[model samples]
Target: MGYGELIIRSYDAQNDRGRVEDFERRCEVGPAKRVFLFTDTLGDPMCRIRNSPIYKMLVAELDSQLVGVIQGSIKLVTVHKPPNDLAKVGYILGLRVAPLYRRRRIGLSLVIKLEEWFIANDVDYGYMATEKDNEASVKLFVDKLGYAKFQTPTILVNPVGHRRFRISPNVELAKLKIEEAESIYRKFMSSAQFFPIDIGNILRNKLSLGTWAAYPRGESWGEVPSSWAMLSVWNSGELFKLRLGNAPFSCLMYTKGSRFIQKLLPCFKLPGIPDFFHPFGFYFIYGVYGKGPLSGKLVRTLCRFVHNMASSKSKDCKVIVTEVGGSDTSRLHIPHWKLLSCPEDLWCIKALKNEERENLHELTKTPPSRALFVDPRDV
Candidate 1:
């Protein structure tokens, strides 16, 4: 078969139908197994490239036949606040190429093209993620492209059958009616970081099992209003939830997503979280706000509530996952939360721009510190 001509261009909605079909075909291969396809029908690609912030559609034309395609997006890093020196960061997501086109550097070319796009758009930082088990793709990013491992968010797996989790003492945890939860959410919106949990979105999340809150009886950690956690049960046989205000223990419950920000504001921003990291199958354990000793207790209480809820939801779902900054002080306090052996790696590149380089130098006096990028889901 002849090697294809690769072309990278702006997305055209009219051409997407063919692209979607091509994408579906590629998904039959093992490399695309993890890609969540969203369809108007069953199993459509969840990632609508047309709706993405900055998207690229790469098509490889072999002689005249379209043999391969790769799609990706660049979005602002919204979860973690950037250091002053590196305020503008964009992330690359949903990268895939046809299996037949593998080993020909098509994937690398797609990434390089996206990097070029990032540089041109004045985005000085870029990052991407892949599962640790994906050795081929990992090699492509690390060896071929010169991207380094910046962060590694661990992925913890627990069998769905093992349903053993308990709530903490000295704190009262209970489920709140949906209306009550929404009211509390609205009241907290003023102080929340990512406010206004799309009520519609919440309703659409059929998996949202319930919401829980924790209240401290005494003056433990300066006015701890009852902490809240929301549970989402996925059809994939996974139970997920988020805990607000409690650190350490609580961070393990939810995946980092927009809902997390709305639930917790004034919380410490973990570095190197890309926006594309969806909180699927993972539980968010803390509210987005407040940095104090009280955060840990609040997280614990919320975790207890979520654990109880998970047991009630189903006997199938077990194990909780959350992400925290390597520097998060609360993480230091938790000695029993088993750390995963291999962490998800975040690979980033400084978009080579003369002006930005000068500004970065003036601010940091050194190259900005690199991070071990972790996918929000893995965290």
Candidate 2:
């Protein structure tokens, strides 16, 4: 029978061990051979999808034969600060086909099933990621599936190496116990676009190597002060930094009320934003908005404080990377630093829905571009 006659279905946990073993055997000739081929012990490749308010899965099948699988999850994408409206978007990951089924429409059929799944879940847009050099996969996503390149996935590298960060006298850095830090993080995230990075999960899952936070000393007591930064070290000792600041008051004034105008406008008033606030300005950097003085002096102080902390933490790490879109202000500052190729590449598509198409214009006010960052493992 033709491969087109094969079937694709939601991953069956009962049969996953066998399926994974089969996949391993099929991909033995390519780069996939280098990595261990074991099904995630977590069992649900769609675990993230299940947690998502909007998630979907599909399998391609012809008669009773399994041919391929597709999975997607929904989330928001922001060019800047927290509280950005969450959009109905889908991410396509874990697309696989058995080697024997090559050059068949099974993969395409699987994606079509995913598209239907997205429509049912109210998702108007979809995106996925792939290695830059994966020609066949790229062609399939772009040429065959009609997916467009939204951003170039990049890996940024910091050849400077990792060293212990020292806090600037003007700024104070503290290593909050995980429990205490998570408490503060949860409270502060209510107004921000912060994702809950469970410290406990990090510890238990061995996802985190270490974590720390930095803020102006006197500002720590109430509301957990939005004007601080956090750094989490992953298993590879790679550093991920998040800086918090106020949203663009001017943009707010142009659209919303002026209540936060006083707080968010000052950063723009400064001769230049601090290095720390520039999202794409450096490797291993990320940011959120909070209330703060936007003066050059204040910016410099904050940047110094953050720099001290990051520099010190680099001691154990070999490389750092951050993702940024083309039109983000952070991109403007990136020219000031050194960078290298990133392994995590992005694959994005335009909105397929009319309302969402209009929303895209609003959300993505800036031009689209790809970002690169160096994976620590390669360093």
Candidate 3:
């Protein structure tokens, strides 16, 4: 059966769980030659967007078999016009089609239905992210759907090992209360692009491990240092797991060799690679902000702290991940492995309302800000 028999309907967790899970397992993502990634939503397909205040998921069924799925959520976010000027934006994620369903237009039908829902909810703009190298996805949204490329962000990833990172002794790290964290972020980062108006809800989310600030030892939270930095962690590891497929031989050899060496020389304490062959989880770092000449160094220290913190967790967190605008200055200090990171993650957007087309066009042409506020719930 083809598009004629395709039916787009709301996703039901009770009835669609098995079919959806099986479909996701068969749809491996990334380049075929090198390692590919599979995201397991831990049986809850809506885990990514369930935290949002408004969200929906739709699935396509062909010949009585589930063939495709897409999820979208709406939220008010800061636009380029003014810090106070907010727009209701809808985010699309977890778009997938069964391997055999490719070229049948089932994917298109699912996205169209989701966009219809976004329009009904009064979304000003709709957007989604994918790897720059994903040619098929790029063509589908930009070429087919008439969406324009809006932003190119980088996905920074750093492996977590047994070794602890060393931060400068001059700096001190302190945990901040939820209100304190909210105050700091709003006071300094409110002007940032895409800054979520519901940031407090995110910080208060059960999955949010906590927020922290790094400044001089003698300094107090009351007195903000010019070189200070702040960050928050989301326990995404609890929401889902990631697995690497088709790994190169060299990577396997290095991981195995490092483990063998560590066993032989306990004193060596070499940082061995995590078990990639099996499914593993990761911690997501978001709300990265800094200032002053020493701010870069402080940001680096904060990233290392996150690395060490993830390593200490009882769960199997193999990596620390975050996304930042391509031109974001703080990215220069964030620790990430090039081999595991994506340099150019493409984001495309379309105006759901015809009247908002001009605003969307202006956004696409505007230069990226130095800092971008990545909402952890989007991941």
Candidate 4:
């Protein structure tokens, strides 16, 4: 039941849920119950894996105890060049090993197995995201696995409240069908992560309320629009809650938390509102993009419109959150309250076998210091 008796296989929810819970609580220190984040399709393993077309969840067991778990997904991303230009990329997420299994190389083994799974599925490139301060994960993916630090993204939490609801009459927000949304997204967004091909899957998700694009007043979508911005909202409150055991709220506030403090005073983060939501519910906005010189204005307009839309639907909807690369200037337009900022998250990547020599844009080019649209739908 010790080392040699360990087993790694696809996730078996019935037998593994208990062990997974142990691993979850053991690894995330501060608050035990607070770690269960609300996502669409609650309790489903695929939901935890970021809802990919093809994905695998692996778990390691010893004496029938689940010691570790990891998930990987494949997506065909259209790079800077399109029209038959695509990269079958593999993404690794949700890697966790029990505290007791630390330094046992079990973490490394799980990653290797997931990579093998990626290869078997015919992925041309592999990548993963982790905090810059996570020395173990960084080393595991970079030094040990030959992956390189790709992008450093800043994740911002923008709360929705009265101010956001004051959207200007000059700004018009329009909901778009998947086809309409993708047509524009593909045409304008170059740094987007997930391909337009799978966007329907994300927009149609039960947790996702809908998608929208913003065009300045007097300029409508499908018209000669000078600029455009788009966003999709997720009903996180309906999914799950963060129960931060006994950790002091002050401790969670990292930087100048005045902004976050002012907003949370209303207890928006608290659970159980008029909407039958036990946990604090908010709109998690993703798949956002702002293009054109007027994009900054469009970005602000889109955010306000989405926030107001969410607030009108649910009084509990009090925040919008998204992640962008540090080099991305779009962060300027996307407002945020600096409650806390995690260590910079680095995207590390590596090339897979039989990759096209000429069409390896993912490896050849780097994103500009402009807006980078990382679809939160991916994870």
- Number of the top-ranking candidate, with lDDT as the measure: 3
Candidate 3: C-alpha lDDT: 0.86
Error of 1 at 111 (Å): 1.3
Q: What TM-score would each prediction reach against the true structure?
A: 0.55, 0.54, 0.96, 0.80
Tens digit of per-residue lDDT, candidate 3, span 1-379: 3245788999998999888888888878775665898878898888889999899989888778888899999999887753346889999998888877788777788888999999999998899998888888998899999889988988999989887899789898988999999988988888888899999999999999999888876776577676788899998889888898888888888999998888899688886777788889888999988777888888899999999988787468999999988998888899988888998899899988877886776789988754678899998
What is the per-residue lDDT of model 4 for residues 1-379, given as tens digits with 9 covering 90 to 100? 4465768899877976656655655565322343333222334544545556787889988777778888888887754433454678788887877777778888888888888888888887788887677677887888888787767878777655554356778777788887776666667664454344566666777887777877788885767578877877776656543333343454445312544554567455332112111345566777677778887888877777776776667766656677776776667787676753342667877777654534444443655434456654554
lDDT, residue 265, model 2: 78
> What TM-score does model 1 achieve against the real structure?
0.55
**lDDT-sorted candidate list, best first:** 3, 4, 2, 1
The Cα local distance difference test for each model comes to 0.44, 0.47, 0.86, 0.66
Q: Which ten residues in a row have the lowest lDDT in candidate 3?
A: 78-87
Q: What is the C-alpha RMSD of each candidate to the true structure, in Å?
A: 12.1, 15.0, 1.7, 5.2
Q: Write the per-residue lDDT of candidate 1 for residues 1-379, one digit (tens) a residue.
A: 5454666554454755556565654443223344332222122333333333455655554455454555555543322233432234555655655566667776777778877777777775555566556788678776777655544443332222223345556665556577765665555432221122243234234444555555555533224454423322223333222111222433333335433653465254422121212222333332222234455665555554455555566443333444333333334322123432224433434434555444433322333232222222212
How well does candidate 2 match the true structure in TM-score terms? Answer: 0.54
Better of 3 and 4 by TM-score: 3
Residue 274 alpha-carbon offset, candidate 4, angstroms: 16
Kindly indicate the candidate among 1 and 4 with the higher TM-score. Answer: 4
Winner on TM-score between 1 and 2 is 1
